[model samples]
Target chain A: MFGRKGKKGNYAYTVARVKAKKSQLMGDDAYQKMLMMSLPEISRFISETGYSKEITSMTGKFTGINLIEHATYANMASVFTSILDSATGELKDTLAADLERWDIWNLKIILRGKSFGIDLDSIREDLVPAGVLDAEDLEKLMSLDVDDDIIANYGRMTGVSIPQSVVAEYKAQGNLAPIEDFLDKHHFERLLATIDSRSRPTRLYQEFIRKIIDTINLETILKLKLEGIHGEPVMKYIISGGKDIDKKLATQLANAETIAEAENDLAQLDMYEFIKDALGKDTHSLKDIVAGLRRYKMKEASTFSHLYPLSIIPIIDYMLHKENEVNNIRIVARGIDAGLDKEIIKGLLVI
Target chain B: MAADLGMIMIGAGIAVGLTGLGAGLAEKDVGAAAVGAITEDVGLFGKAMVLMVLPETIVIFGLVIAILGVFVLPNM
Candidate 1:
């Protein structure tokens, strides 16, 4: 699969295929249609569309809204599998490793949800299958009791993932906080590891990851302020991989009386435009940062598409785009079921 | 003087032939991409086909050089 002919030109073929797939993703028209359906109707709709096979197989075992939920996971897993299956280089393996963020997410969700005695099926449905964890493995994970499974999984993921101390923190606090922080930290770190050193293409990818980390930290800060947390305690929660957020700066931002001041402080970076967009004048929504990450990654992928025609970048780009597409579809489907406005649902979509 | 012309003609042929290799290099990706696009959406097939063949222009230029037999013209 590593085979690729030397092109005076870079990976245009892979880029072209990725571009074609991106174009096939559901746009506003479908998003609008999706907002009008009930959960059962959504399942039927997905059954008729690209996600049909997923919906059909799951329908008999689980029905109604849960069908849409499980089928969403199935579609996400299938898409990730397709991308990994299609990938062709050393870069392919690296990209796949980065996508393992899903495992961390799944483990946390299972541990925290079960700890609170939430039903397995409901917790299972909330997972976004954008990572390397298979549906069977996820089922195995979901079946286990919360805290033990978390520690055991931490040991399993230790060499390539977060260490045991973090899991110990989870056990100690009995809260998902530390474990979730570790997962976010590892996700960004893994993204940093995958880039080619000193290349413009990889640098752009790295920046995108960094920006996302910073955004998440900012959101955490916002959440703390809303809860009236103060001083050094809130500072401890900040993840360290963001572009400009060091320990002291993170704490200061968290302690700020107004989130707008924090936004203003972050406005001078090269990604000034994106920071501005995320902060949105007087009212900041770090949710905007999450959306910004998706957009930024798309821009980086398309920009790099002209290089390494059949290399790993296109495959990675396709995977990211596909995950985002599936998420948007689920939102639209759920929004429709919830009787939300199409325009409002559209605003909520990350696509 | 005549020998110099023969040498230059052979040199030009090699140069032009290598250009086909360059064109071939470009074609592989374009072709694969076009095919993949067609698989996803049939409507893109025609336009993708046109774009995929675009690099073949390099080969055409090389062919023109060979057909003219640059030797037929004065060495000036």
Candidate 2:
């Protein structure tokens, strides 16, 4: 992967562009101001910033929370698409791989909507067109009638293996969890397959993916523990390829007697030092812990980006920051629409 | 004696040329990032310019050595 051609790829140019874009993301100050605004005021606030074009154009069609949410998603999709478009060679492939999470997200949305018989238009509205799949492919996937047809279309579009067993399990359970787990596993498998551990950039990418898997495992284990589920059953939901929480530790954590025990088990891992406070807090809710983990990961990504300025880490950092901004604004807009208190909404934002 | 002078000249040429190449290589990424930073906020132009030219010092040092080899050191 570190051949002459790979070396010649536009690392300097792409990283520079991404760094600039990163600076333009919403700061904590902006989010603080947004927490006090009503939905319309929030919309106006966004319109005066980087999201002006999207907010202005979407204002005619959508209003209130929907307007802000849709505009945010649209702007996110466009920006990410442009980033993908701007990249080439190995960088492009790495970015495309990273962005495939959006496709997975879109698929999950469709699957959930379909199972519940929600309208396709509503599902489409939630979709972010930021991955390898274009609008046409998503439209086709959305219009497909049967589960088999949808799975086939998804497999074809994403090249991710959707095993028949997952479908069978979904049918038997009447829940989307099986299918979602399968997709998550498949995504990580495909991601790990493409990345060469020998290359610095890909190695960093791999490390990031492993951390995500570890975080997901920790979250799942904690949630299941809270639900009174335990033993080997919980291990089934734990995705593989985690850096810190290997299969043995995952099983141990899953089998821990209580959430505190699970926290102790996690404390033995490398991330313990970083997450000690969050895990140690007696009053910390599951949601707060999960959000704390995400924040920690984002901070880690920022460090990696600074350390390796020309690597894929900076681009990933930029994308994560952008995603956080989008999610934060959505929380504020929706919180205002639902008449939630400013402090509550502010607490929900990751910033 | 003429051959010795030619070899010294070649040594000086290599020093300047390779150092210039090294400086160029270092400057490439810095320049790109600077341009990107400037694109986001024009206020960074001065800072970017300073950073973008920082690697040129390597080339300047190389040139000084080359000058010494060619003019001053040879006379000594």
Candidate 3:
């Protein structure tokens, strides 16, 4: 128990504000309404909600689903930044570290953009500045010519160690997968490293991250197996530090003859009961599994927040809930724009 | 009689002080969570206020005992 002594900031006030925002997050009913509307109508519906300011500001320049997508990303960044500003002490550190995933994401985006020779303006448009990097830092990164030296410089500037070998491998293979894998691995390894299992809240946080790692590893294995790839190559992509599945089990799961067999192997693990339904149907794709994992994580966070209301769990849960809402809305809007059917688009949503 | 009066006064002081401490401790978490709930929905102001003060009952009880000790019990 981290005793409530010398703990800076007023979590009560922050938590209260977060809860207020959480309650206002759009529900299934709103999504249903948005699903039927045209792209412009979808944008209008969003303007009436929390996203009104961003939508209004961008309306002149961008329109349709593109405007909605950019607005959603921008709003997410602002909301997260506000949360970071409100937090202090351990909570702030935890949130900052957790949010650093966005930095990794942005780095990946930049790398991918460079790989494909995409222009700076397009790359800049795709960025979601929800991490430690402020807009100015992102602007600087975007302005720099995409190459190994600039990438290394970006890493040094951000204090994120992008291993030279990953860049070398990217150069050798002329592919982004190696670099992406390295970044993903680096992020998770660093994330798991920060979590101290001694404290209850942190231990819960550790479990949350571990579950995520496990899910990522499982999805990787399933995807690789489906592609008729297996053995050591599959093992290379599997992230460590999972709670239910260890390295050996992951390797075995990866080597399994089929997806169903892999799911069967997972069924023997502790988290089988929770993830079984997601893996039950043969028709279930990697997207379904990933969505199931997100749902499970959210459910676990909600339970933890209920059990420990005053701690960091509730705040983290609220953050995840906000992210999910934005993502779901984006998916619906984009799906509608692409002329996808209602049910199909609905399936794409995590909510 | 002087010593007896001093002892009764000390007991009254202890009653109020300790119970007030207990009440403060109890209200700390409740008040925090109540404030949070209220912020989420302004309509919950009334409900949160009620919940926030519920722990004060302990201090009130303590005050009652202290008063009893100082006045009625001293005579008894």
Per-prediction DockQ scores?
0.46, 0.56, 0.55
Per DockQ, the best of the predicted structures is: 2
Taking chain A by itself, what TM-score does each prediction score?
Answer: 0.81, 0.93, 0.92
Off by over 4 Å in 2: A1-8, A270-284, B1-12, B69-76
Higher-scoring candidate on TM-score, 2 or 3: 3
Sorting all predicted structures by DockQ, with the top scorer first, yields 2, 3, 1
Candidates, ranked, TM-score: 3, 2, 1
Per-residue lDDT of A123-192 in model 3, one digit per residue for the tens? 7667889898877887777777757766776677678866878878988998888878887888888887
Q: Kindly list the per-residue Cα lDDT of model 2 for residues A98-204, writing each as its tens digit.
A: 88999999888888888889997678778898987777888998898787898888888888768888889988998889989888887888888878788776788
Question: Candidate 1's error at B40, in angstroms?
Answer: 2.8
TM-score of each: 0.81, 0.90, 0.91
Cα error, candidate 2, residue A265 (Å): 1.7
TM-score of chain B of 3: 0.91
Q: What is the lDDT of residue A312 in candidate 2?
A: 82
Candidate 3 per-residue lDDT, tens place, B1-76, comes to 8898898899889988999889888777678667767755788788888988888899889889888888997677
